[model samples]
Target: MTDSIVRVAGLTKKFGAFTAIDDVSFTVERNKIYGLLGRNGAGKTTLMQLLTGQQFATSGTLEVFGASPVENARVLQSLCFIKESQKYPDSFRPDHVLASAPWFFAHWDAAFAARLVDDFRLPLNRPIKKLSRGQLSAVGVIVELASRAPLTFFDEPYLGLDAVARQIFYDRLLEDYAEHPRTIILSTHLIDEVSNLLEHVLVIDEGRILIDQDAEQLRGSASTVVGKKTDVDAFVAGRDIISRTGIGGLASVTVAGLSAAERAAARATGLELSPVSLQQLIVQRTTSDTAESETVTTTDAWSARS
Candidate 1:
């Protein structure tokens, strides 16, 4: 891996006596896109706040480009944080935000921002407070993309964007990323939407790392097999099953790993196999511990075996 653009060791964040981020340590390599995933209240935001120096770490160290980022102008100037509810001064208009970008971003692209405004159909004259949620989100997208920060943190950048605008944002982001690769940390609940764009995923559940792996490896690590209930059970009897479900004589089993031998064996049993997607994996990993997950038990998921 290239030198880490972001490094956190024993990073901790406390709110009064409650600890939000608990000694989280990780390295984000330069020029890579990382998916920061978790459900609500998973400390994903806290981690981002620390990395971007929005808030101080209670304990441990945080380094962006090999130096303490807290109050460090050199580091802060190269970073852009797109927040969920990006606030603006009351009555401030979209044009005002654009006018101020040059002061904050060293390489601010005025032409790109103007194009985005046109594409997003933002009314430059309208006050930020008067704009709809979707328009507000579009404003942040414009700034973040046009700013071209070396380390960009997109925290739920599409909070209220509709499908069409969201697609536009994704398309533009990918196009720009290809031409100008940088370290990006995207935190969002819309896992399935950006699953393909994520090179790596770090999943935190209730403030703990639930899953961390390359997207490709994660895709291959599990598979769902369906067939006669008995045949399916027999085929999965000795293998590691992540989850399963069944109705009557038909059964669907999600298992880990499928070697050539296993695939051949499953085919002989007339079992249908399909790859488990990243979204499915995240769902299985995060929701299994809940009491309601028992409803999924009769379907015969091997997640318990994990």
Candidate 2:
């Protein structure tokens, strides 16, 4: 097998006259956690749909598990896609979903699924229609984690989960992945919370990929510098400033790509520079109108900013 389990070359998805994912391409390696990050309507969901074979791509080549996945039972059987607003039948109950999961997944772990239900305090007999938003989200996480699909896509898996419950979910995920490694693509906006768990990150902006890099590499790409407003502005004048703020004589400016020389210079100048966080970098790099702007970045500067 190739190093990548899923590969998309020039992938595009259009909804009528407008495109939801454009010219996007990437390779997902096995046994690594990938963060599919972007603002709302930035095509994150659309891209996941394409990768899971839930929707057809309008153009370009797509391969999952080294073969075309369109209506292929062998390939579809190995994929698990738990969506944020996942819909169940009107009369469906949480127990019903659990009961039927094993029929579709070859590696379904009933014991693990039951443990997750108890861990999340989910009511198996509760009607899905009557479940709270948070409870509904919990069920999706349970199913995705227990399914043990070779390639899993979690689209906003922890929507209404509280901080404690979310942490528990993360803990369980890492523990299980450690034992049975596979490809997991998690799409979420809670960047900092899950940043440490991701091995790789893909930042989508307005239907296009803005950044594709190792999570560790991103930690050094940008930094925030604080100092006198004049000094801050002067130091930032010739560089690419991702964001800037000031109050009276003091200023804080976030800049992209601070090399060793620049870091040393900042230290000498008494400018306190802190590494920019993954969340802050993501929010700053994505366009404000990303939901419907169709304004994908045409350059590499956005990746640097992110």
How much does candidate 1 score in TM-score? 0.92
Give candidate 1 misplaced runs (Cα > 4 Å).
291-306
Lowest summed lDDT window (length 10), candidate 2: 291-300
Model 2 whole-model lDDT (C-alpha atoms): 0.88
Candidate 2 per-residue lDDT, tens place, 1-306, comes to 339989999999999999999999999998899999997889999998888788999999999988878888889999999889899999999999999999998889999999988888999898999998889999999999999899998989889887777988999999999999988999998787889999999999889999999998887889999999888887888898887778999999999999999899988888999988787788778856443233223223334533
lDDT of 1 by residue, 1-306 (tens): 678888878888899988888877788888888999987889998888888888998999899988988999999998999677777889799999999988999878898888888888999999999999989989998999999899988988888888788888889889889998888888986787888889989898766677778888888888999999999998999888788789999999899989878899899889999888777777777774553465345223433321
The TM-scores, one per candidate, come to 0.92, 0.91
Q: How many residue pairs clash per model? A: 7, 0
Cα lDDT of all candidates, in order? 0.85, 0.88
